[model samples]
Target: MEEETRLSRLKILKDIAELLNKGTDTRAVLSEVLKNLLNVTGLQTGWIFLVDQTGGYQLAAHENLPPALTLNQCAPMCSGECWCLDRYLDGRLDKATNIIECKRLEDAVDFHWGETYGLTHHATVPLKAAEENFGLLNIGSPNKTHFNKEELALLESVALQIGTAIKRINLTQREQDLALTAERNRLARDLHDSVNQLLFSLSLTARGGKERSEDPEVKETFSYIQDMAQEALNEMRALIWQLRPRGLENGLVSALKSYGEMLGLKMDIKVKGVINLPGSVEEAIWRIGQEALGNCKKHSSQEAVTMYFTAKEQEVIMDINDEGCGFFYDEEKELPSLGLRSMKDRTEALKGHFSLKSEPGKGTKIRISIPV
Candidate 1:
């Protein structure tokens, strides 16, 4: 009987490994994993959560959840705070643990979502591959209040496999992204070298013609040609900037100023305090600044903008202001634009504050503050 039991567990693990190896999609693999786990272990229900660096968790997979948790398309599982996620984000959960009572289930009951189907507890296992922690795996049976030591150990082992699988998938995706980035860089370089250079040369030639022409009509034609060529040149440069940003190596301020100029706008930038920041933080700010300036150019109809940046020992604050046409904005109202929503989401993902102010004919202002 003992040999047969061990064999059964081995087969279960083998089946799981195959599933993990078969799929590249994280959520799909997780769903299948949970299903296979329930079948092999006689668990009534299970869920897997994958957490990102920003402390956001996604319910990647789940099986046999009760009506309460599944209501409203898994709204209960997706939103709000939970004990396991909080503990994991706080770095307090490092191994398999028996959460005697799930906070989510309790909340569901308290809020009267629906029945929990007697699932009051689960085994929470921290998924890790080597030293890198990924997320959590939870397994439970109906009326089960605790997990045995052996059960916890087995779950931990399986969690490790899951973690390793996730790492593999993530690395693969990163490799593909890098390849796409390289292709974009190549295209950007080609456009700058060939098309952009031709446009610049055309503008210079047109200016020379305007200076030499004696007839007013000829001079005006040459002037128009020069302006058009210059405008096209600027547009081409903007495309290149979108493809691959240059000068980020120098500093954020320099990059933003350059980008604004590429969009045919002048930048009035002021900086105070030493500007030292992490790579990730600087990258996020750069993206946000780009979008803000782009919106200013497109909608604000401004030729010049002002930027103020302050970097302290513990935090950084940036403000962008433009004196141009502005539309009404309400904080309570649903975000009316994708650009605004994206900026807010990205800022909040870093645990930062994002605020925007705009009124008809009063210009627009954006402010962001982030802690290190």
Candidate 2:
């Protein structure tokens, strides 16, 4: 039986490595790792907590968790001083440690919180490579009284593999971020040097022609051309600013307010709760805001727009409303407008929700809610 168990562990480890090798996204990789760990090890529940650069623990992935340990209940333990985290931080939890008792679980059991399936103990393995500590991998089973040395060893091996894969994914993401920033800078420079200069020159030439012409109609035409060129120049600058927004370094709200001012739109902004979010989440919100504002400028005649941004414990909400001319369409029969479709796709890609409302005379409102 021992030999069979050892062979089975080896096969499970091989399968896990294969799955991890094919994963590209960190979240997806961690989720698959948890799933595989539960399936192969016969554990009832599994979870991974990742330590961010700020020394905060974030729940990266989880599977088969009992109701008593729902995400909301587990959230406080993630950031608070927990046994596993304290040990990991102090470099004591370097190997798989079988925790015979967990305070959180014990409290839940004592309080008669939702079902825990008699899970009283769990094993935690630090996910580390070299000197870098990534996080902790935790697995628990109701039937198992204690994990053996061999099982602990298998857990350690799996944790090492997960740590390596996470490191690789982080490096790849950094490379991609650098590449994206470089491209944005290049595009910003090109637009300023070429199109911006051309528009400025056109405005100057149109003004000069208006001043030189004696005919009233000719002067009026030249004046209109100059105004159009100037407006185009302003729009171009706004676009360039968006391509390489310096204010985004400060925060999303500041960047968006600046953009709205540049577009000559009066913005009524309301914010609630703290706005700390992941980089990708912020980018998605910015892009969606940009698209919604663009549609407003093109379709709506209203000069003022209102936006409400709210950040809750687990999600962020953004609502943009403009009192402009709206159009009617059958939701079931026809597809959404191009801009709306793009917004929907972006929201859904992040596992969020997007909704739009409009009428013939009434204005348009777009609401997006995304989990952080």
lDDT winner: 1
Looking at model 2, how many pairs of residues clash?
0
lDDT of 1 by residue, 1-372 (tens): 979877887888899999999889988888888898888888899998888766767788899999999999999998788888889999899999998789989998999999998989999998889888888999998899999887887788789889999999989997887888799899999999999999999999999999999999999999999999998997898878877789987888999999998787889999999967975678789888988988988999878899999999777999999999988988989777998888888888777899999999989999999876
Q: Give lDDT tens digits, candidate 2, residues 1-372.
A: 989988998898899899888988988999987897888777788888988544567788988777787847565355556688778887778899888787677777777667888777899999987778899998888866688898899999999999898888888888999899899989999999999999999999999999999999999999999999999999899789878876888888877777776777888899999968988889899988888877877789887888899999878999999999987866665446788898989998877998888888899888999988
Candidate 2 residue runs with Cα over 4 Å from true position: 1-6, 71-81, 245-372
- The TM-score of predicted model 1 comes to 0.83
lDDT of each: 0.89, 0.85
- Model 1 worst lDDT window (10 residues): 275-284
TM-score for all predictions? 0.83, 0.67
